[model samples]
Target: MNILQLNFEAGWRGGERQTMLSMLQFREEGHTVHLLCRAGSQIGERARAAGFVVHERKGSGGVIGFLALSGKRYDILHVQTGHMLTWAVLTKLLHRTLVVYSRRVAFRLKGALTRFKYRKTDLVVAISEACANSVQALGIQHVPIIADAVLPVSPNATRSQMLAGQLGIGQRKVVATTSALAADKDPLMLVDAIAALKKRRNDFVFVHFGAGALEPEVRARVAALQLQDTFLFAGYQQNVEALFGLFDVFVMSSREEGLGSSVLDAFSARVPVASTSAGGLKELLADDRGLMSAPGDAGGLARNIGQLLDAPDWLGAMTSKAAEYFERTHRLDTMADAYLVMFEQLLNERRRPRTAAIATAPAATPGIAVESHNQA
Candidate 1:
């Protein structure tokens, strides 16, 4: 399969990481994969370093220009981010290739253009059922759900210890969170939860990974609460998954999430998770796989953190269950294979003759008046 992945994210995040994982898996399986990303973007540089055919464009306008001028063709053009859907739609017009859009967020389609662009997609694959329901709300049927792949973790105890010492988390339990410090992620709430948890115990330190728009507000709140020692900020690291072994518990305080990919990483590392019930997080943490709290409930989150720390036996059993669940359902190969199957099914549909497809269509009842339409 010839695949062209379009991801224009300026920074690396869950969606960008998934895109890279999918590209690497497709390449490993002997498929020809190409990447189209923004110029100077982290994903573009990373893709180029990974030895893929990288096309770096300036912006959305640059993407349109490239689609108009490059004259390249592929078996599939997959839009990995929502913002780049317009460009992908235009690319479909220029190349007439099978267009697939990966919907990774659980945001409802709110605008005319957004709905139109989704309608134009040959296939829309959602990362979770929450995201699929969001797309299906647009009245588009058959939205398939393909969960995000669990990022592979290779733990080095030496590296983990070194990182713990570097972060000043020596000998103390580590409560880690790897998410953007944005409003939707609710980092301020995490600060409050850490403060509340500090009141209960002082043996654990909360280290939050990744940075975003709400950094100043989050810092201000942390300082006001005097959690300088209890709360630590570790800015985004490229191989964050490698250090998951140091985490005693992974916590998320997201107000909304499509799927908490970090929670999956925590599962892979066999670390207990304590996350709020936000969107697809409920799905991942179901069946006592992890501790859960209501969204924005700082008190509840604090209590869950305390439980995860206090009960060692239960914690071990829960982590073991979580690891088994992740291994059974969320491997990188599973996601890549599902995508290949979808790609082949779409290609077959394209290959079927128009007249033959029409002839096979179900006939309307004899007494009913059938509506006729012609549109693409």
Candidate 2:
């Protein structure tokens, strides 16, 4: 299928990682996948590197820019949420394009305008069950909870062997979190959590892998908490997935997450995970395979970290389970196959004929409102 994916984020964060990997997978399967992103963005660079067509999304309003881009008789319009919904509605009205909303965030959206935009969409694809629920709560029908998948790649060198000299980490007991230094990510919480761990143990060091706006505050927080000796801000590294080998456990301190793409990286490397029950964490770790702390509670986060550090065997088991869970339920083929089915379904309801037989239009099967999106 000739698919067009529109994303608003320019930087290569977790969400961008998911999008890139998915597009690459489609290309590997011989599908024509084009990515619409900001000009000269990290996403554009990465997409081009992976051999996918990367176009710039221009204009003050993304809705206008996206609608103009939608005119080339594509098979499906895979879009992310926000003001772009206006474009999706217009595309559905004018070009009869199928709208697949990928709900990457789990927070409930307010206002009637937002609700109406969702109604105009044909299907909603969420990264996790938690996010799917948020779509349904807004009265959006035909919501499907599709867990995020990582396109399989051969294991690369571990970060420990790559940076063994500078990090002061032995390459065995490193606990890492790959998130942007945004205020909402709470990188300092992970620092403080590790600091609290030092009172009882000294076997591990913490690394926050992504760079963002809160770097100075995070450094100050580490100094204030006297955790300067242990915490490392690894900055933004494209080979972040490779770093999973350096860490024994993956740590998350997100105030909110649609679903953590980094956690999947850790799992792929067979690393255990400890996270707050924020956003999709509760749903992702529901089988008790991972530890979950209360959101925004540094003390609770600290306790969760300590649990994984002390019980190496238990943590190992959890890591294996996480890897197993991902391999079984979140394969890239499964994600792509589901999308293929949705596109085929949408094309059947298409009224206006396009130049391409593959062109699919927005049309939802009646009374098919999905409710399990709230499952976590």
Candidate 3:
């Protein structure tokens, strides 16, 4: 299959990571995969490094039009970002290309334009059941829940030791979190939890990875709370999996989340997780694999962390269960296979015969009268 993957995001986040994984898997399976991403974006650079054909564009506007006008057809046009989804809709309207939109966020589609775009997509791939449910709640049907893949983490003890030494956390229990330091991530709540944990036990240190717009604010709160020594902001590291070896426990303090891919990473590393039950996190961290607290509740989070830390045997059991669950359900190959199946089903549906009058009908306003065929 000739697949054109579009991700206009400049940064390499979870969505971009999933796109890369899908492209790599498709290529390995002898499918022709092409990437269209923002010029000089980390995703573009990495895709090129991985030997995939990458088309760099300044924006999604003219490039998508150019592709449609140039008569370069793709079997599937998979859009991985919201901006790209608009372009995909345009391309579909002009060329009837099979467009698939991956909905990774749990936000509802509020406006007519957003709803119209989703309705026109050949398939909607939601990264979690919560995301799919949110789409359904918005009255957009035909959404399928395809959870994001988590690559296996090969522990590097030397790298972990080096990271520990650099952070000055010798022999200290490390409660690590990898997330963008933003309001949605609730880094301040994490600082509050760290403060609460410190009052009870000072043997542990908190290390946060990743940078974002709220870094200054998070830093101010950390400093104001006098947690400079206890809380270490490691900034953004490219190879995050290597550092997972250093974590005795992983925490996700997001006020809102999609599926919490970092929690999946923690599972891959066989580390116990403590996360806010935000969005699809409740789906991933079930069955005693992790402890959960309500979003933005620092006290609740602190209590959960303290309880987990106090029980080493329970932590070990959760870690084992999490690893087993991740292996069974969230492997990279399994996710890729599921996507391939969806792609095939969409392509087959497109090939079915339709009455000329029905086929030529104008795109209707979504969530009104039109019924979608691929609803779960």
Candidate 4:
């Protein structure tokens, strides 16, 4: 199969990581995959380094250029971000290629433009059930839930020791989280939780492994709360799985999340998770795999973390369960196989004369409430 993946994000967030994983897996399965990403972006650079054919372009205009140049060469166009959804819709109108969108956020599609773009998509793959529900509510009946996968890593004790020395977290229990310090991530709430946890115990240190617009604000709050000693904004680290293996516990304080792939990374590393019950996190942390708290509640987050810290036996049980869950459901090959199956089904359906009605339909417009159930 020939595939063209579109992602306009300039940062290396969870979505970008998943995009890379899918592209690499497809290539490994003897499929030709190409990535169209922002010029000089981390995803583009990484994809190129991984020996994939990468087209680096600027914005929606770049997307148009790519489609005009080589869009017809691919069988499928997989769009991985919202910024590129409109471009994908336009491409679908211009080509026979099936346009598949992966919805990574749980935000509702309210705008007419947003709804129209999604309605015209051939398939909408939600990264979590919460995200699928949100998409279905917007009248897109073809939404399917395909959870993201994480690559398991062996614990790198040497790297952990080096990181500990560099961060000055010697002999301290590490409570780590990997998230962009943004409003949605609620980094301030994490800081507050760390502050509250400090009041009870000072033996643990909080480490964050991401950067965002809210970095300065988070740092200022950490200082204001006198948590400079307890909190270490380790910035963005590429080998997060290695760091997860070193962590005593992984905490997620996001106000909203699609599925919390970082939590999956923690599970892959056999670390217990303490996260806010935001979006699909509730689903991932189910069955006593981890402890959860309400979103934006620092007190609850602290209490959950305390439960893990105060009980080693309970933590071991949770980590063991998480590891089992990861082994069962989060394998890279399993995710790749599921996607390939969906791709084959869509392609086979497209080959049917009866399904050609989708191509004969009127072009989607901003105001038209296209009832996608016809194609669904």
C-alpha lDDT values of all predictions = 0.87, 0.74, 0.85, 0.86
lDDT of 1 by residue, 112-194 (tens): 88889889999999988889999999989989999999666787789888888898987899998999988889998999999
Worst 10 contiguous positions by lDDT, candidate 2: 367-376
Name the candidate, 2 or 4, with the larger TM-score value: 4
Q: How big is the positional error of residue 294 in model 4, measured in Å on the Cα after superposition?
A: 0.2
Winner by lDDT between candidate 4 and candidate 3 = 4
Shift of residue 62 alpha carbon in model 1, Å:
1.4
Write one digit per residue (lDDT tens) for candidate 3, span 1-376: 8888989989878888889998998888778899988999999999999898898888766667656774246778888999988877866656667888888888666888887888887788899988898888767667888899878998889988888899899888889898888788899899999999889999889999999999999899999999999999998899788889888778999877889888889998988888899999999998988999999999889888878767676677888999999999998889888988988887766655444445887886678664333321
Q: Where in model 1 is the C-alpha error above 4 Å?
A: 354-376
* Model 3 CA lDDT for position 69: 73
TM-score of each: 0.92, 0.87, 0.92, 0.92
The model with the greater lDDT, 2 or 4, is 4
Ranking by lDDT: 1, 4, 3, 2
Model 4 lDDT tens row, 172-239: 88899989988889999999999999999988999989999999889999999999889998888877
* Candidate 1 lDDT score relative to the true structure: 0.87
Clashing pairs in 2: 133-373
The clash count for each model shown is: 0, 1, 0, 0
Query: What lDDT tens digits, residue by residue, belong to model 2 across residues 1-376?
Result: 7787777676777777777767777677777888777676787787788777776766436546556556345677787646455566665666566777788888778887788888888887888877888888886656877788885434456445767567666634777788889877877677777877788787878877888888998899888878776787778876767656667677889888888877777677777788988888887787866889988888888888877877766676787888888888778888877777777777655532442432454564688653211100
Looking at model 4, which ten-residue stretch has the lowest summed lDDT? 367-376
